[model samples]
Target: NNRFTERNRCPADIEKNLEYITLIWLDENIDDSNESVQMQRLLYKMNNYVLLYTDPHLCIDYIKTIVDENIILIICASLHELVLPIIHSLNTVRAVFLTCNDHLKLTSVCSEYPKVAAICTDQQQLIKSIHGTIQSMSNQTMSFTLFDSNKQNSTRDSASILWYRLLIDILKTLPHTDQSKNEMLDKCAEFYRFNEAELQKIDMFRTSYTASKAIEWYTSECFLYKLLNKALRTEDIDLLYVFRFYIIDLYSQLELEHHKQFRINNNWDKLIVAISWASNFKR
Candidate 1:
């Protein structure tokens, strides 16, 4: 009984507050006569609240009759019905809702008003478009090939360098299985030759030189791995010591990036393993 009393009182409170709030309820089966009477009374009272409940055919008429520019249009039936008029009246209105159809129309509307647009679609295309535009503009302004097809091919060259860096880093962590080690060496040599040949075709001396340097670094890393594995298997102290000294010397010569933590961790692991193996031989 108390709950029922409170519920009955709620509507009167809502009506009192309706003057300060704009409410629109849309439905196909709305009682038109009753709605018009109630809305007319509210208008006569200068309540400042607007309400519309009508089908798509009567939407334009319904919108014109409502005096409040600050109207909340609730779209309950067909989205096309709501979207068309709302878009037409874009100059007067602030916001809208389309609760029905999910189609390209929603996306088109949202694209026009991004701030109030809630339509969902393929976001990847939007992101790609933004990135491409920015990249193109930046390249044009700076006069650099950010995504160049030719002209030293900075992007591709940098990518190749990063790839070799990763391979070398991975090789240092993995334990030496003789067959796997041999396969790795063969692949390194093959890829290095392929990349070096491609770089030489570019006609940019600096790019070719950088590619050559990368090839040398990768080749040396592969050779070092093979030598380390061989020394470990044969318990050759002289060979292990020579490879260790060679690694130290190579480390000094390389202009490695400060952010190569992955490579540094792998190298540290390999160094520890080498030290352990050497101690075992001494014992």
Candidate 2:
């Protein structure tokens, strides 16, 4: 099943995390109320993958399944004691927002764990805090592995880096086709099922996209940007393969722009710079 199950219900574990942020909401009162529905809609605006769960244990299990993305967990005050202890130690669980009142109890808990954000009793305050925290985390450095050739234990890391470089090269050479573009848009629509704003963006892309505007779409920071950024950052081979349609266009457009940067009066401008032979680029 897709991430957004019927009525934002708890979904089965996703095999991997393919995005920068995931907001997991664990509360017993996730009923069909205006407040709950509005809160969830706001959260979706910040991050597309928002999971709703009533059972603390099931939520924790889902959290454990995520690897590449940072999780922003929102849980009811009642479940904090049982859930916080388990999630606090997990590196993926980056920020935790505890809701409901009892400031005295939460202040003590917050002191013990700095990762736990401020206690948000009011719904508006909770959303504001979550929005700020998500913005902060988005700016924070993403997870990546460094490969050092000098280290003997770097075999795996180094190989993975090489593999990624090779994969990019192969994708750049693949023939772009209408079929590939359709596949990409279909997958995006599936993943962003309940996200109306992103769906509209996707629809626009389907009707108006062209290879010349590949970089524009990539940098728009819309659904395409979020999905592409995640796939590249996580080195998700399967997802990257599906994104081949846009990747080739991105490469060709970059090449076109690079060529244009040197043109003056119908003649290519000469560029001069000093760098050692060991530098990655060669003239």
Indicate which candidate wins on TM-score: 2
lDDT: worst 10-residue window of model 2: 269-278
Evaluate model 1: give its lDDT. Answer: 0.37
The segments of candidate 1 whose C-alpha lies over 4 angstroms from its true place after superposition are: 1-21, 29-52, 77-87, 101-105, 113-283
lDDT of 2 by residue, 242-262 (tens): 988987677556556555664
Candidate 1, residue 44: how far the Cα is off, in Å: 20
lDDT by residue (tens digit), candidate 1, 1-283: 2111111122223321111123343445444366435533442232223344455545544444443233444444354444554545544343444444444555565555532323323333323433343343323322212233344247765554454345345444545343443443443343233234323432232223232243243233233333344344343444443333333323333324211423553332222222222223222
How many angstroms is residue 123 displaced in model 2 relative to the true structure, after the best TM-score fit? 0.6
TM-score of every model? 0.25, 0.80
Residue-level error in angstroms, candidate 2, position 35: 3.1
Runs off by more than 4 Å, candidate 2: 1-17, 141-161, 258-283
